[model samples]
Target: MSLVARIATLAQRDAITTTGIVLSGVWLFLVALFWLLAPGGEGTQGGIARLVVMVGTILPLVLIWLAVRTARAIAVLRAEAADLRQRLAQLRDTAAPRGAPRMAEPEPLAEPDRQPRAPAPVPVAPRPLSRPLAESRSPAAPAEGRALDPVDADTLILALNFPDGPDDSLAVSALRRALQDGDHARVLRAAQDVVTLLAGQDLYMDDLPPDPAPPAVWRRFAEGARGSAVAPLGGIHDAAALDIASSLLERDEIFRDTAHHFLRHFDAMLMRHLPDMDDAQIAVLAETRSARAFMLLGRIAGVFG
Candidate 1:
């Protein structure tokens, strides 16, 4: 049998209850019609009419109760069907392979003459914060033929002081010696000494600690204020130095600013002494074996060939 026919048979249960209820409804209707149309006049006739009226009222109540039960059964069957459909959908979802995409509804076919359009381009996501510092480096430009400035020297000085100023004994000694000698030639020599010390450290510049400050700190540092924290060179006043160093070193900034001490003594000493030296003295200083720092500074300051 078809599904509808099967469900009808289940509700009827061999059709006995359904047939009895239908007969009962028709009987009660007929009896009511008779009583309304024909009124009995005498005592015996009135008693028989009252008996028929009582039977009609009782029959309808029983029929109504059976109808209510049948309706409840149909409602229960509908609920079960709905629950089964939901479970089936859930099972299908669970059974799908781990890597497989979920099945989507099929699209309607287009006109025969039309070709399929290309899919939309997917958006690219940005790199995460944890990406390697090396990958974040900007392309380095050619330094040759480019004129260096005091800013460049200043940036280099900041790079040297990253985390903290030059702690190298040799460079410190030279700086102190120049201060004591008070000679322009000796000051030139001292600048070269500092450069030589930095050059040696440059070999392992990659080994320095990472910049702990955020990009905002670097931005502010570029503006002239030191960073909010201690720098690798050990102070914030020259935070822009981080940018220059990162460019030269071709790495990301990753150093923390700590403590609260402030000093511009190194850059000050260079600025004060560099201007006193004549071109000839600077030239002499640049020619020395340890004169790399002096050459860099002199080129930046336009003081030496």
Candidate 2:
């Protein structure tokens, strides 16, 4: 895009520098007008004279500050605008347009999993958290196993971030470090860090408690780690993951390990049977999610024995 387009896009965006530019402009204009309209001090040369002098000095200072502020704002806005234009151009090139952007259409802002027509995001499969447990080494597993990554954990945790929130980069890093250290307990703690954000009544990002709820990378981790068999009983449709995660919030501390372990087993089975299953079969699978959740929480008897 051209320089003007880039500047316009940055001005269109939300940023602190943009606010500074606006306030500076208003102050500069009002002060300049006062300098023209106000009369000069008539030998009132004392404290009042000093106050008048300060006001006159402020005019030049505000002017200089505004000049600096405008230059910085323009520089940042232009850079951001260029970045946005490049992305829009790339998107226009890669994926075929599914349909028009509509009021109810899948938003560009929605998590990548939320898109349906573009491509089939991988169906999840079961696996261990810290290390691959014994049963996972068998021939039945797909030769390559999905690693337990922070990004995936964040995506699974999507129901947790507030609207227009900052990207979940920090949580993703923390979770990844925890996983690399094989400290699964710390990973659970990382997951719990987002509990208040996801469970909060306020939906706006402004009111969010400074930190995003969770990393988007792997928020839907139960399914990401295990696959869909342990997916929230709700389908992966609107608000399904959110509702399911909300339900698990209270029990997460108590059941973290069991939920992780059971999902690993259940996901392996689902992946194998998935080819033979239809929607009816899928519904049955989803319906059992609550029971699976119960089993995780120790409210139900184990069927393995």
Candidate 3:
């Protein structure tokens, strides 16, 4: 167990013990005072009466102590259980799949036309593409010296979701191309910052199952809709997630700032790109990890009413 958990458990035990002792002491003191003030009749009958009184008072004290101890024990068990669950979540997040290559080292970006290999088992850090965007003859020219394609909606979605692992060649390639564009790179970097921040608090976009709003609702949000009209787009209603996010937004300066930055970039991206996308494309985009992060953070940031 964590040191904080251990300390909390010990504190609870101490409180329970102290309360039990105080109650028992008070009852004993009252009983002794009553006995002194109003003595019983003499001899065997008196002695029997005193013995009965002693048992009566002591029995209740014992029972009360037992009840308090049981409650404290149960509370401690619950605390330990919660602690175990949190540790398990963290372990699941950090553990790489068996036989998956470690992606800690940087690798070259794959060609966009090349067929993607097996999905990678880990996320790779974004690296500079071989050819810089400046090398392109025109604004629409590809980042590579050859005729590279423009960043399409599908590529943008893949880049937003980010590569799941080292073998996620498609996503990695998309990310590489997206990073070459200034606007796409800004949105991508903002999304990444917020995702990392959320992960630090054990909040993952994949774990949050958002309510699936229709494409119309997303379109409305993409426009200038706000308040109740765009509220449906803020579909992430997980109570634990909302509570954690709300708390962080209220208390953590860095988290609050990152969330707002992500929200701004996402809103701008939607306004700029949503017009070119069909309902199907919008739906697909909404399902991406980055879009999910946008929904979660947007709701917390009050972007949607």
Candidate 4:
């Protein structure tokens, strides 16, 4: 990006830092102009007054700039720390031992001679064919018989929550599985983008406790209901989280794009499974970290009015 575009992007991501930089530039320019135009003939007292005025004007601006820079540095560190932790966890999972090898079996010579004799065939019962889970559950599935696998669904849910720590082997395994899946991979990537953005702003889905809405409300959302009719689906009401998410959606281009992308995939997945899921399953899904992120972002996006 060009300098101007970079500045614009910075302004969108961190308005306070951009504003401070602009104000500092303008302040310094005005001070320089004043010093250059002012008469030079003055006593020691007059010189001291000028010095004091300059210091007074520059001090507060310097402090503001310092504070903004410090905040930016802290945010960067937090994001880096999170990235490092995730990388370490991934490394641990990758390096983990699979299992012990099986022992070799002894050769069977006498048994081979006995097996030469003809053996009677056993009757087997015919098994019934069934439709894909996705097709059986809802017509809203993206493809006719390409339902999301139950294992994939579980893995996606686990991935959305993210691994709590290096010890969370189950979540790590699920995340790996989700990434390997073609369809689930898209949703995982989108969710990761949004989650990372949210983390940059210090807004973790795990920290936001949303109001528990009924499964029927979630079902309505899955069925395409929006606005006030399904507003309850956006149960996250944390003021700080709402304000930050709302501001980002309105200003940050990257964040807005990822949030929208994540929303679309999540909604599609929900629609495909909600019809077939029981109330308990829906409730379990609603409690997931990804679902919470959805509620927060969906509310900010006005999907729930």
Candidate 1 lands at a TM-score of: 0.23
Off by over 4 Å in 4: 1-152
Provide the overall lDDT of each model, using Cα atoms, as 2-decimal numbers: 0.34, 0.35, 0.69, 0.63
Q: How well does each candidate superpose onto the true structure, as a TM-score?
A: 0.23, 0.23, 0.55, 0.51
Please provide, for model 1 over 1-305, each residue's C-alpha lDDT reduced to its tens digit, 9 standing for 90 to 100: 33664565466553545666777787778777977898766656577777986866786768776775776567556655665455434533443221111222323323433433322222112111111111001112223563322222222221222111223333222322222222322333333233322332331222222323333333333344432231321312233333443343333111101000001233344345345444433333222322322223222232221
Against the correct fold, how does model 3 do in TM-score?
0.55
Best by TM-score: 3
> Against the hidden true structure, what lDDT does model 4 obtain?
0.63
lDDT by residue (14-80, candidate 4, tens digit) is 9767777888888888878987998876556677887999787879788878888877766555555
Of candidate 4, the 10-residue stretch with the lowest lDDT total is 129-138
**Which residues of candidate 2, in runs, are more than 4 Å off?**
1-44, 67-71, 95-305
Superposed by TM-score, candidate 1 places the C-alpha of residue 238 at a distance from the truth, in angstroms, of 76
Question: Candidate 1's error at 98, in angstroms?
Answer: 5.1
**Candidate 2: tens digits of C-alpha lDDT, residues 1-305:** 56766666566544545665677677678877887998876765798867986877577667766766677677776776566556444443332121111011111222224333222122323211211101100011112443433323222222111111123343332322333323333333322222222222222111111111122212233334323432332222324433454465455442344345544443443343334444433433332222223222222222221
Task: Put the candidates in lDDT order, highest first.
Answer: 3, 4, 2, 1
Please estimate how well model 2 matches the true structure, expressed as its whole-model Cα lDDT: 0.35
At residue 249, give the lDDT of candidate 4: 92
RMSD of 2: 20.6
lDDT of 3 by residue, 67-181 (tens): 8889799879977977866664454344323111112323454454565532333322333221101111112324356543456777787677766655667676677667767
Candidate 4, 153: how far from true, in Å?
A: 4.0
Higher-lDDT candidate among 1 and 3? 3
